[model samples]
Structures are given as C-alpha cells and as structure tokens.
Target: MLSRRSVAVATMFLGIIYLAFISLGIPDSLLGSAWPVIRPDMGASFGFAGILSMVVAGGTIVSSLVSGSLVQRLGTGKITLISCCLTAGALLGFSMAPSIFWLVLLAIPLGLGGGAIDAALNHYVAENYKAHHMNWLHCFWGVGATLGPIIMSFYMVKHNSWRDGYTAVSMIQFTLAIVLLVTLPLWKRIAVSREHERLDSMIPQDQVGPELKQPAISSKANVLQIKGVKQTLIAFLFYCGVESTVGLWGTSYLVGARNMTAETAAGWISLYYGGITMGRLITGFITLKINNRVLIRCGQIIAIAGGGMLLLPLPQLFLVGLILIGLGLAPIYPGLLHETPTRFGRDNSAKLMGYQMAVAYTGTTFLPPLFGLLAAQTTIHAFPFIVIAFIILMMMSAEKVNHILNNQTKSTGINC
Candidate 1:
C-alpha cells in the first residue's frame, strides 16, 4: 500500500498530467481553424500549409526519437514544463508574427515541445497509471483539440482577429506551466516512490516472480530487439494513418460523394470528432471488465463494420459511418499503449513507446499526403476506399503483433 503522502502526490501528479495533455492539443488544431485568416494576411498560398506541417512533423520526429534519453536525464515534470514554455512561446510568436517566415520558424519549437511532452507523459502514465486513466487522458486531449478550433472560431467572428485567439490560449499554457513548476515536488515524490519499489524488487528473485525484464532495453537499439516491437510500430503507424486520413478527408468525401452541402458536412465532421471523444469516455469504463487485447480487437472489428457502411453507397448512411468510425477508432490508441508494459517489460516499454510515437507521427505526416495526391489525381470518391485500405493494413499489422506476442508468451511460459 502507498503512504498517504505518496497517494496524495500521485493524485496531484495525475491531474497535472491531464492538464499537460490538454495543453499539448491546444496548438494542434489552432492552425487549422486560423489558417483561413492567417493565409491571405501573410500573402501566402495554400501550399504553404503543407510546408509548415512538414516542418512541425520534422521537429516532432526528432524530439520523439530523443525523448527516451531526455526522460532518463531530466524526468517528465521538467521536460513537460519546459515543453509548455516552448509551445506557449511559439503561440505568442504566432500572435505577433508579421510574415509567413516567422510563422514557419516558430513551428519548429511548437513541434519539439509537443513531441517531447507527449512521449514523456505517455510512457510515464503507461508504466504508472491505471488503464482507465490512460484512456481518459487521451479524451482530455480531445477536449483541448476541440477547444482550439472553437477559440479560433470565436475570435474570427467576434473580434475579427485570429491573433487574439493565439494570445488567449498562450495565457492558458503559461498558467499550466506555473502549475507544473509549483508541483515539481510531486514528480520528485514519484521518483522516490519508484526508487523504493526498485529497491524492494531487488530484495529477492522469488518474491517478485520472474526476472523477465531487460534493463539494457532502456536504450533504443535493445528495445527494438524486444518481441513484437516492429509489428506494434507498424500497427500504430497504420492506425494513425487511418484515423488521420478519415478525419481530414471525411468532410470532402461527404461533399463530393454524398452531395452534402459544405455547412452540413462541417457539422457532421464535428459530430465525428464528438463521437471519438464520447467513445473514449465510454471506453474508460468498459476497459474495467474486458481484456485489453479484446478491447483493441473489438474496436477494430467495429471500425471495419463502420467502414463497410461507407463502401455501400447508401445515402444518409454516411453520417452513421462517420460516427461508427469515430467510436470504433476511439479505444485503439490508448488500448495499444496500455498493453505495452505487459507485452514488453516496464523498462523496455518506455523506449518502445517513444519509437511508437515517432512512427505514428510519421504516418500522420506522410500517409495522408499520399492519399491527398491520389485523391486529387483520380477522384475524391476514392477517399473512403483509401481509408479502408489503411484500416485493413492496421488490422493485419495488429494481427502480426498478436501472433508474435502470443508465441513469445507461450515460449516463455508466462501469461500476457
């Protein structure tokens, strides 16, 4: 059992972590909404959006690759607090930026901050927190993600200034940074608790069960040697691609294929995001009873069913497909991460999680653009078909992960 102080510290730390996740998301959707206003004002073409996005993705990929070593050195709290500062600073730059050159330059720090904090917190929580909190944490990010666009929309219509929206959200991040700094002691307490557990674990071999953990996996090279790592990475990659492609292109598909008005398509896409948020909310509770693998597989099966609806060419059924797709996509991200500690040892999962994140963001960066080109060259009608192809790839990769893990577990004679 945890001491009273330890439990209290854990509670406070968990709350801070959730708030950090929300901050992580604030800038993610902000640019998308504000782009309409930001573009013309800076005398930039629409193609500049892709250039800026790639810059951010490049920064994220670099940061995520190095997150394991950084976390080992500085710890999650320091890294997260500093990351918040970086992003908040970038947002301020966005507010004051006089040209597209400044905006593009600021995106580097924005991506670096976002990636570091994301990988650090994910591995920390996956090792330390419960299944429900993991799922709920992502839901909180959805809250920030949703809030970003809303803030932009408000400033656009009310004040006729998108810059003000960036300023306002920057204040929120600054506030969160202060809270993190004040609660820095909580991370120290968590560190102490972890050290004590490690010492206790060193007490005897029999008491702690099998010595299955490989500490050398703390490095990226060794972590890749862990069973199912590559397959899991592939699964995450395709999963993120499927989710992004669908979410980004679903509005267009609705417009071109279903003949819906732009306004109606926008509303339904909003509902699709709502479906994701709501589904994660529900998933947090359901995970209490169901197995993790079962939850993941069930989520994919349901998503496949939703994808089937899209392929049917039925009118008004596309809305149902959108919601179903959102609900089905909900649990997979967190659920996959939740299984990491068990599939690989706790120490190894830390590195693997970072790599998983890097690969996932890579998918977010590249695959959607590929589909965009394909859709442009052929027809927008191919959007759903492309999404479904990615969905199938994700499923097959997941199956490979399961197969590898199951065989490894059997060979070791341990339950996973």
Candidate 2:
C-alpha cells in the first residue's frame, strides 16, 4: 500500500496535470468562435480561415509525430511547461497580430504546444489512471473547450473584441504555465513513488528512473505493422476530422446557412462544447458499467443521427443537432486513448500514442480545408454531409479494429 504522504503527492500531481489540460484546451475554440468577426476585421475571404487552421494543424502533426522522443528526453512535466509557454506566447502574439499572415505564423507555435501537451498527458493518464479518470481528465478538457467559446462570446457580445478574448486566454495560459513551473518537482516525486510502487503489473519492466523513459519497442514502421494499429489510426484520423471540421466551420455554418449573428452563433457553439463537457462527465460514470467498445459504438450511432438532424432545414434543429453531435463525440476520443495500453502493450503505448495523435492531427490539417473548398464551390449546406461522411468512416474503422483485436484474442488466447 502507498504511504499517506505518497498518496498525497500523487493526488497533488494529478491535480496539477488536470490544470495543465485546461490550459491546453483554452485556445482551441478561440479562433473558431471569433472567426466571423475576425474575417470582417482583417478583410479576409471566408475560406482563409481554413488556411490558418491548416497551418496550425500541420504544426501539431509535426509536433505529435516527434513527441514520444521529446517526452522521453524531457519528461512530461518539463514538456508540458515548455508547451504551455509556447502556446501562451503564441496566443499573445495572436491578440496583437495585424494581418492574416501574422496570425498564420502565430498559429504554428500554438499547434506545436498543443500537440505536445495532448500526447504527453494522454499517454500519462492512459498508463496511470483508470477508465473513469481518463474520462474525467478529458471532461476537464471539455470544460476548457466549452469555456473558450463562452469567453469569446462574452467579449464579442459586450465589447466586440476578439483580441481581448485571445488576450484573456493567453493570460490564463501564462498563469497555468507558472503554476506548472512551481509544481515541477511534484511531478518528479510522484513519478518516483509510482515507479517504486510498480502500481500495475502491466507497467513495462524496461522503465528506468523517475522519468519513466524506456527505449522504443521498435521502429515506428515496425509498430505500424501490428494488427489493428492501422485501423485504429484511421479511426483517429476521421474522428478528429469530424471534430476539427465542426469547431472550425460550425460558426460559419450557423451564420451562412442558418442566419445567426456572430455573437449568438458563438454562444450556441459554446452550448455544443457544453454538451461535450456534460457528456464526458456522464460517460465517466457510465464507463464503470459499460466497456470502451460499447461506449464508442453508441457514440458513433448517436453522432450519425445528429448529423442527419443537421441536414434538416429548420433552424430549431441546429442547436439540438449540435448538442447531439457534441455528446456523441465526447466518449470516442478518450475511450480510444484509454484502450491503447491494453490494445497494444504498455511498453508500446507511448510510441503508439504519438503516431495515433499525429494521424489525428493529419485529419485536422487536411479535412477542414477540403470541406472549405467544397463550401466555397457550392454552399455551407455541405457541412452536415461532410460530417456524416467522416463519422461513418470513423465508425467503420473502429469496428474493423475491434474485429482484428477480437480475432487476435481468439487465435492466440491473449489480449492484443
């Protein structure tokens, strides 16, 4: 059993990690929620937002691809602190940017910081925490996501100031970064305690030192050759495609298709993220009763139904559809993350987490821009159909992964 002091240290460290995640999420929705006003202010075309988004996503893809190595060298605490500072700087730069060019450049660091934080914390939580804790950790992320738009909406409604929104969030990031620095020693203490505890038998025997670094299982290429890895990566791709596309374009769709004011649209978008927050909170409890696969399948079905509702002409359906979609999407990402150590081995989970997140960011990078082109050629009405396509692809890929893992289990009498 852990000593009371060890338990206290672990709990404190986990709390710090959770706060870092909030910092990770604050900037995510800022651009999307403020884009309508921003477009008019900068005299940019509607589709230009996608270009900006693509730049950010590209940076994230690069960062995520390399995060495994970076984390091994620097440790999660240092990585997280450095990433937060980068994002804080980038966000502050965004608030002062005079043109779209400057905004595009600033987005690079923002994405890099975000991707590192995401990969590091996700791998950490998946390895150390239970299924419910994973769900709740992501629920806090939902809190930040939900707050982003609300913050933007408040500024837009009251002050007509998108810059102020970005500035406020940047301040929040900076403050969290400071908190992370002060508590850096706690991460080390907890890691050492847990390493000594060997809390789970599944923890790789190869882990060394308080940092918990281990040599790679094999080349990335070899890891990809594992059964179900490709399917899992594909599922991640389309899942993030659906999510990023929604956040990047949902406000535009609200204004262009459904004829809502920017402020109002921002508020409604917050409700969408609010659904995500509440859904994940509930799903944390639900995971005690249901396994990850069932929750994932159920979420996909509900999301598909929500996409159908989005295709309807009635404005009344828009909010309902958005909420449904948000709730539906809540479980899948965290569920998949929590499943990684079991699906692969704990030894491989860190490396796989990086690749999985890289592919996920690849989806974020390309899919929204593709839809932007589609919307530019035709109408924003294509948004729902595009979302439906991504969700269906994601669902099929996830099911295939399940089948592959199931077959492996049956054939070998071992969990894949």
lDDT of 2 by residue, 158-200 (tens): 8889999899899999999899899888766776666667654
Query: Model 2: residues >4 Å from true position, as ranges?
Result: 33-48, 96-101, 149-165, 195-221, 248-269, 309-319, 375-384, 414-416
True-vs-predicted CA distance for residue 155, candidate 1, Å: 2.4
Cα lDDT tens digits for candidate 1, 1-416: 56798788778788889989888887899988898889999999988988998899988988888887788788888888888899899999999999999999999998998998899899888877777888999999999999899998998899999999999999999999999899877876786786676567564323433323212223335788876788888999999998888878888888988898999998988888888889988999998887667888888988887887887767667679888888998999998888787677776666677788899999999898899899899999887778778888888888888887667655654533
Kindly provide the TM-score of model 1 when superposed on the true structure, using C-alpha atoms. 0.92
TM-score of every prediction relative to native? 0.92, 0.83
Candidate 1: segments with Cα more than 4 A from true spot: 191-220
> Model 2 misses residue 223 by how many Å?
2.1
lDDT of 1 at 321: 84
